[model samples]
Target: MTPPLALYIHLPWCRRKCPYCDFNSYPAPAAIPEARYLAALFADLDADCAFLINHRPLSPLQSIFIGGGTPNLFSPAAIAQLLNGIRQRLPCSAAIEITLEMNPGASVMAQLPAYLAAGVTRLSFGGQSFSIRSLKQLGRIHRPRHVLAAVRAAQAAGCRQINVDLMYGLPLQTLAAARADVERLLDLSPSHVSYYQLTLEPNTPFAQSPPPLPAADVSADMGEQGQQLLAAAGLQRYEISAYSRKEAQCRHNLNYWTFGDYLGIGAGAHGKLSTVSGGQVARVIRLAKWPQPTAYLAAHQSGHSQIAHQRELSAADLTLEFALNALRLTAGVDVTLFQQRTGLAAEHLSAARAGAQAAGLLDGGAAGRLVATARGLECLNDLLQHFDLS
Candidate 1:
């Protein structure tokens, strides 16, 4: 089978770190050298191309995602240059989904048209909540009105696909408030919706000084209610935290969930590639770039650009990997997906399955694909721990 390839570019700088976010993003100070950053990104892509040449031929890039500190902060020219660099080194499909993440703020909102002109086919708005009080509590700069304006701007710019992100379980957020947020989000009529519960990640302000989130039962009720709201609006939950209209799901993210290959180029980017040793058994290799922006740039300037902190994925590791991602989807993957993606028997994890099924975590039988039974998805971390890499 041919290997599937995609490109991921990371922008490590953010205007400010959201109190609840623990992503590998840092606050951007004044006077960022925009030109230098673009040049570094281009050089980073160039280095990745050299590595791809050693393994398999470059397939047309099926997807390209320019993700945050905030990709919209960069000028259209800078973004264009980055895309040009990818095109020069790798071939791309005619309908390649090129997505850029933008904050629902004034400055980035103005750049929507220019980004569309630069070949951005999709725009995803980071509209965390519609509640003005919740927005202030989360340290978000944009108001509910700003989010509406941003969506309109992207639509007016002729963007074919638009995704709106919503957050739940905020401090002081009641079940009523969460439902209101969902109602407001559906009112915008976005092609895609991503609703995620707030988690206080380590090193984040909310983690250090924990907020009083809704209780477990309350959070579950809020999630179920929001899902029902989305369904009524003609959107279906494809994966945990992600919902979409017919044919509106983000292919770029689906690539990640299906265990496809992608080249991650940018600070703190991560990728998984399938390695076949010329007609022998194939192994899946995981690659990660250095996280720090300054350090990564320095490494790129020096000669060795890619810095993979980890590489190997054993048979047991691959089984766990496939189960962990595939099971997250509402429509569980086919039983054959295990052997196809992991090159292992589908029954490899049968022992774990029996335990999970007996405990009301997974379904039963051959056609019974593994999934987080309602209770399992809520305590996903605990379910995932059953197949620990260690």
Candidate 2:
């Protein structure tokens, strides 16, 4: 049997491009072309469904993650249309998790009720910080009050699963300021929190002219202190950057961590799927759509495949890819999961596992669990080197 499946939809329009973001998002125009985008997305979904029918039938979708360039820019009607179209094309559980990402502000809060009514089960806000200066430095347009109001609006709309995103290690950040952000986020009483450290990703404005952020040790301290604060508030760390209350983990991301298959739709979405033939794993395919919205739309209108890239994972590739995502979980995955997901024998990891064990990077040695030591989690890139074949 195939692993669990999920669906990912990308909306690549934001009100304004942040200085530090590296996602495939563009600034919104005065009026977004919602109808055209909706049509294209539906067409894309139809094509993928047809393709799946010829290859392998999918299991019920476990979750749907509508991520973006601030997906809140779309009207609730458009979202409803999108979700309805998906259910018509693909089979999914009635209780499948549906998450929408948005920036916290008054502009979008008024529509939260309609959005919840449209089938969004979870709301993830880009509540980057609570400090006025931090918001300005991070190039976020929403005020701190806006974050509070957004959460309140979601709750008033009867949204039960709310996630607040927080960040540490800002340019010239102090330990106290970082703690304040965590405190304010916990005060919102969200079901989940994504606490991240600011990094100057390559090709972003921050990378070209990097700001003076907290030093390495200070940034480490900031993360450590923030996790302690979150645990105290009953939101323990789950994934590397994710903390959540009991039974409230983001199911869509959990699918990714467990190396499950998923379909991708809309601009710049990526997907991984395993094809089975004769009751055996035949091949695992990775596919990505064109990143540019204009180009993607034109390709769709012309009835062309908008996929910009596709590749099959080699045995070595599968070994590393599985470890890359699974090791991110604090508790790790069962040792047998490597073979279950990749179709290769679990022993493919034996040599690399020995190397990691000798280096004190992997714990639960030679057992059912494949956990990373605290030091291994800190130097995850280094730990991944053991799995690297090229």
Q: Which structure among the candidates has the greatest TM-score?
A: 2
lDDT of 2 at 269: 93
Over 1-390, each residue of candidate 1 has an lDDT whose tens digit, in order, gives 435788899998888888887888888868666777777777777766776766555679999999988877778988888888778878999989999999998777678888988889989999999999999999887899999999987887788699998989888899999999998888788999999888878888898999888898888788889999999999999898899999999999888887778888788998776755553227777788989888887787777755657587888788778878877877777766676666677678777777776776665643646667776676666666665544
What TM value does model 1 have? 0.94
In terms of lDDT, the best-performing candidate is 2
> Stretches of candidate 2 above 4 Å error?
none
Write down the worst ten-residue block by lDDT for model 2: 49-58
Task: Estimate, for each residue in 289-318, the C-alpha lDDT of model 2 and write its tens digit.
Answer: 999999999998898998889999998888
Candidate 1 residue pairs in backbone clash: none
Q: In model 1, which runs have C-alpha deviations exceeding 4 angstroms?
A: 277-281, 365-368
**Span of ten consecutive residues with least summed lDDT in model 1:** 273-282
Pairs of residues at least 3 apart in sequence or in different chains that clash in candidate 2: none
